[model samples]
Target: MTAITQLSPRLLWQFFDTLCSIPHPSGHEAAVRQWITDWAQERGLVTIQDTIGNLIIRKAPTPGMEQRTGVILQAHMDMVPQANADVDHDFTKDPIQPYIEDGWVRARGTTLGADNGIGLAACLAVLADDKVQHGPLEVLLTVDEESGMTGAFGLAPGMLQGKILLNTDSEQDGDVYMGCAGGVDANITLPYQAESVPSDHQALRLNISGLRGGHSGININEGRASANKLLAELLNEINKLQAGIRLSEVSGGTLRNAIAREASALLTLPKSANPALAELITARQQQYQQEFNGVDDFIDLELVSADLPQRVMTSDLQQKLTQALLACPHGMMAASRDIADVVESSSNLGVINTETEHIYVQCLIRSLNDTGRDRVANATAAVFNLAGADCEFDGAYPGWQPDPQSAIMQLVLNTHKELFDLVPNVKVIHAGLECGLFKAIYPEWDMVSFGPTIQGAHSPDERVHIEAVSRFWQLLVRVLRQIPEDKAASFK
Candidate 1:
């Protein structure tokens, strides 16, 4: 057993350690799902799999606690698969090699999957141990939460019997989340005309790297630079110089929910323009460094020689696409008036790629209300549409509105204060959570999201605090036992 399995909360850490051995990246969850089902069955818990592949496990109430309101512990089953550009690890076949660093547990060269893995571990720990007090309980493990909230969106009505849900997905250890932002995916496709590269032109690749690309929703307000936008800006500057550069290919970012950290472009230009292009790259890199000073510590730009490509995008197409990319808005757009110091609306220019017939772009827009989200979505679409690209919005989900008079929220607040001698922060997150979707399906269900302190989520730098997990478990255990009985109906 690893040292992590020997943490204070042994069962939770052990389960998390085992999870690190499995490959459960978004949309490829069968192996991990089957493992969880088999493990639950071995423990004799009642397990059910919904049509959308969401898993539900049930445990009867503790003897005298049967009269309390039924509670559901919720978390997602998938993790975002991200790695540093130089990391050679394959997420599908290799285990995430986790090790202790200072006081946190982190993977060697890839994402640690602790965002929901720790939450899932907590649920399993509760199920396997009978010592914890609770009323009727259900554990809901949803799928594909990182790429898309497919499991939550397709959740059928009346599948769960819980009136209260405790979401274990929030990242901050001492904060209790009451609401979250809604989101939509804006997909843009631009068809381009291609022509044979001139025989006299030489090929060069412009590479952008070393930016701290983080969660598009959580870190969008931090003023981090987007590699896609940076590349487009550089290309636009090149066009102004009348350098006769022809774009052959461009690609950036990995997931739609992560800010573009790295991007590269291939181009063909006359050998005579090489020296000027090199000088321009160095000057642009220095400008970016000064502009993004403390936010993105390392901003690198390089021009390297490459083999000439057979075809290049028509000059008109190249100019139009780069201009559209530059015009698309990114980062925080507005601050919330209702909640102090919180972002109300934002968008991320998450991804861009060149394909054989066309180039594709993806942007994620987030807002606490439908109007703000649609406004940003419309503006983004308008930019690309004017450039002759087709735009479509998909997988839109509603935001969770806060309830001022929630009984469970008060109960959680009181329980935490009593147990820890410190009141937890009751706040709303700008990031999208499945709880918002759950609110639509089960409007009467009172929900709260809480978890341990996780830093650098949705990136290779992801890690979880060791001390925070113990405290998180303590709070969850106490809250489960203090749940009040239902006054309107008799407990089943």
Candidate 2:
């Protein structure tokens, strides 16, 4: 093991550092799966690998605690792979270079994967520690949770034997997540024919970069800028110049859960208006800098001359595409009246691309309530249809409804107070979690989620709080030790 793997928390950091060294991007997690299986076998823990590659490791209770109830500890093994555009790191084979920065462990120029990696590390640490007291334990490590919930959805009906489950995927340390928002992906496509460019026109590429983007779910309501929206805004200004510009191509965003930070467009304009267009772009760039001065200080817009044989999109198609994008909603649609600070409904225009056959756009819609989710999705589809585009929605996952009377909630509250002087805050999150899928599979199971402090998840700014990991470890151990035998029997 390397020095980084041999750091404090011994087994925990070792597993984490090893995980960071391996490349486990969403659909490609074969290497990580084999490593986990080897680790479990070496530890003598009873393990089973599902067809979808989800691993379930079981450890029988200590001699005297054999009669205690079985508890399921759950976390996803995959992460949202993201990095700065200028960084040359590849998620398929590069190791994340994590280091301490301002009290947080962050990667050099890529996402730290602390969102679920820390949760998985905590479970490994607990299983390796023989000194920690606990009942029969089952650790569930899921795959491809960042891109989709495919592993969770493929879990068999009777795969797990535990009646109580503890999810370790929450981002905040003290927040107990009992419920989460349900989400659906709406994919829209608009076909348009391309035409040859006129020899008299000049080609220019317009670029938008350096915006501070974050997780679409967590930052949707924050009013942070989106590159797709910024591009549309710039086009709207360019149209004012009336330079006979013809849009050739447009593309932006990579993941559904990440906010778009950069976008580029190729266009052709009459040579007579070259000087006037350049002046307009410069002035608009400065205007935007002053407009979002404090919030997005690094935001920039650039235009450069380029040459192309053929025009990507015809003038008619470009007009329709730009109008549709600008008409589409791209931010919080509604706020939770029930919860003062929670966002109830929101939509994110995650991805956009222009191709020879069609123009495609992907949007993610989220809502705390089922009816509200449908409403938002319907509204979104209406926008696309109005713009003469065919839209389809898929990958809809249910939300975990908050249960105030849950037995797990009581245990967590009591255990937290006993471990520390203060009680932990219990609430629901606007983001989606695997707990929602698990609840649909086993409605009788009681579930609660909590984790260490992780910042800038789903973005290159991702980080993990160094101190919170130890505290989180301590809290998990305390909770396991306090599960009374009588209470455990009641569930069975």
Candidate 3:
């Protein structure tokens, strides 16, 4: 076992250290779930685990705070599993290696899991603390937040009694997220037909990697390069050069919500055009670097000679795929006309793959409003149809419309200002949150989200700012103590 040094908010550190010792990857959170149950059992706390492994632990109000209202502290239990390719970390069994570096706590070569883990730790720390002054509290921890929101979606109605919900899942500190964008997955599959290989052709592989990829929701508007798009652009350039190349195989991107960081294509080209093809690809790489100099400094493109045992995509299909992807709109499509810093709608060309029988592409569409989301989805499907690619739209989750005048919102704002002597920044986030699901299930519940500063979530670059934990801890306690016992509310 690696020794972990305790940090501020001693209970928080203790809980965080214990959390890191368990393997809690998305869709595989049995060990962590059992650990949490065991911890609650040992404490003799009132706890309940739902059918889908959503745990709810209720803590009675402190003596002086009994008059205050009930508050639900919510956070997802699962973390996105990511690690450096060179690392031998196993998501199913190996414990996360967490250590302090430069003012942040991070995992060695793997995702830090600070995204929701810290929120989970904070809830546990508050639950275990006997001295913290607060009203009735219920800590709600759901599973599979990374891969899907199954646990959240499966939450039974009336499972929680708190009228006010404080979701500790935001990444930025000092900011209160009142609303978030709704998103849907666009899954596509294209049939493949093999063509005869030319005897004068040579196989080559093209790769685009080392781009600074981030969470597709938060970083989608940053103008950072997308590996899927870059690869398609490269192929389009090759096609434009009239290189007689047949696409063999192509695949890129991992998670739907994460920007593609790497992509590769296997192709066969005429041996006679190999020299010219090499020069053209080299020039294209240089041009791409210059074009993305402002955002992607580490981007790299490489081509290697290879031997192919069988043909991949037919020439006609290759041209169609290239044109389809080139036409797909990526990055920020429109900025909000009302809010100064809000992104109204965006699309992420998340994944592209070429299989033995078909070409596949997946896109994630997000918008602050349902109308805009549908428009983006329809536009994307039209692009694929034009290129002879089949498309399918999965059920989309709804966005949480912000309620600025909610009673709980004012209470939190007042408490925040009193505790920190500064007003917290309240706004809607472009990313998807489980709050939307919760709202769907319980329409009357009032909700708001806030958290410590966590950088690079859902990627190996994830880290938790050490200093923000204490402040977050204090803020949570303050908000709990200030909630009014009785409040009437209505949905607008």
Candidate 4:
């Protein structure tokens, strides 16, 4: 048993510790799935697994509680895999080293997986707890929520038995999420030819690191710098300045859902212009630092020597690629006109790859409405298309629409008020969630998402507050016990 399991909130943390000991990054959920399956079997509960690894663990209502409405406790089983560049632990082979620090539970150097892990553990605890009361219970544990909503996408008709879903994948403690943004991924490829390096040219590598990379959806409004965008700006400025620089290689960002934290590039320029190029990059770095002030206080830009290549990108291709990337939007394309301070439409230049054949750029566009998402996607495609690149969009998912009068929503609100003695903040999110995909199939399902307070999700600094976990557990317990009776008959 890990030290975390022995903490104050022992039951939930115990399951969380077991989860951290297994390998379950995105699509790799086999081990954890087997363990949980055996756990349910050992308890003599009925368990069903779908074709795509979505698990349903069902327990009959506790004595005299069967008439209460059936509740589906939902959470994803997979986690986003991320680590500090310096961390040596392999996510696939090693258990996350979680420890308590200043009242928070954090992993040593990798993502703590608390975003949905805590919620999953909470479900496990509730299943094991005889003291907590509930109606006919169904736990719908989906898979691959981070890489894509694959499990939710594959959820077949007639598989789920509940009309009410309580998604525990949300991050905020007091906030109840009713709706979320729909999103799609756009790929832009620009074919290019290499040209011989000019005489008297020096090759230099420019690297930008130390950005507080975060979830593309949750952190879109934070104004944190996108490394891909910043590097593109630098390259575009160098081209405009006519510093005799030629692009050799460019790369940044890893996943389409993560905001880029670091970017680096190779360029060849006239030997004498090296000093001027460095000075310009330094000035731009200072400008960015000032612009980001408190958010990205330690943004670092470095210029160093790199091995010379026989050929570099042709000047025309270099300019075209740089300009297109610069023209492409990176953040806050639009805000909600309906809800105050809630983001409606947004985009993330999530990844860029400069290879021998072409430079590939992938972007994720999100919005509360399909029309808004299409509008921004079309505009982005236009930018790359006008620059002579082929643009395509796919992997689209629907958004959850808010129903303020939903029974599940009102029940959660009342339960939260009773537990915390304060009005719960209910709002919509600008990110994608499995709830959206699941809602499309089960249109009659009433859904609400809430969880413990998790900070820095999808990044190495991820952590869950100790106190908030207990409170969140309390709210879920109370809400499950208070489910109305009429909905129970409807869950055939």
* Candidate 2 residue lDDT tens string, 167-267: 99988878788888889989999986778787778889998888777788888887778888889877766766777887888888888878888888988
Q: In what order do the candidates fall by TM-score, top score first?
A: 1, 4, 2, 3
lDDT of each: 0.92, 0.83, 0.84, 0.89
Q: Write the per-residue lDDT of candidate 4 for residues 173-244, one digit (tens) a residue.
A: 899999999999998898977899998888999998888889999999999899999998899888877778
* True-structure lDDT of candidate 3: 0.84
Q: What's the C-alpha lDDT at position 399 in model 2?
A: 82
Q: How much does candidate 4 score in TM-score?
A: 0.96
Best by lDDT: 1
lDDT of 1: 0.92
Over 4 Å off, model 1: 487-492
In candidate 2, where is summed lDDT lowest over 10 consecutive residues?
A: 483-492
Order of candidates by lDDT, top first?
A: 1, 4, 3, 2
What TM-score quantifies how close candidate 1 is to the native fold?
0.98
Q: Between which residue pairs do clashes occur in model 3?
A: 192-357
Which candidate, 1 or 4, would have the higher lDDT against the true structure?
Answer: 1
Report the backbone clash tally of model 3. Answer: 1
Candidate 3 least-lDDT 10 residues: 483-492
Over 336-361, each residue of candidate 3 has an lDDT whose tens digit, in order, gives 88667998899999888777678889
Winning candidate number (TM-score): 1
Instruction: Tell me which of candidates 1 and 3 scores higher on TM-score.
Output: 1
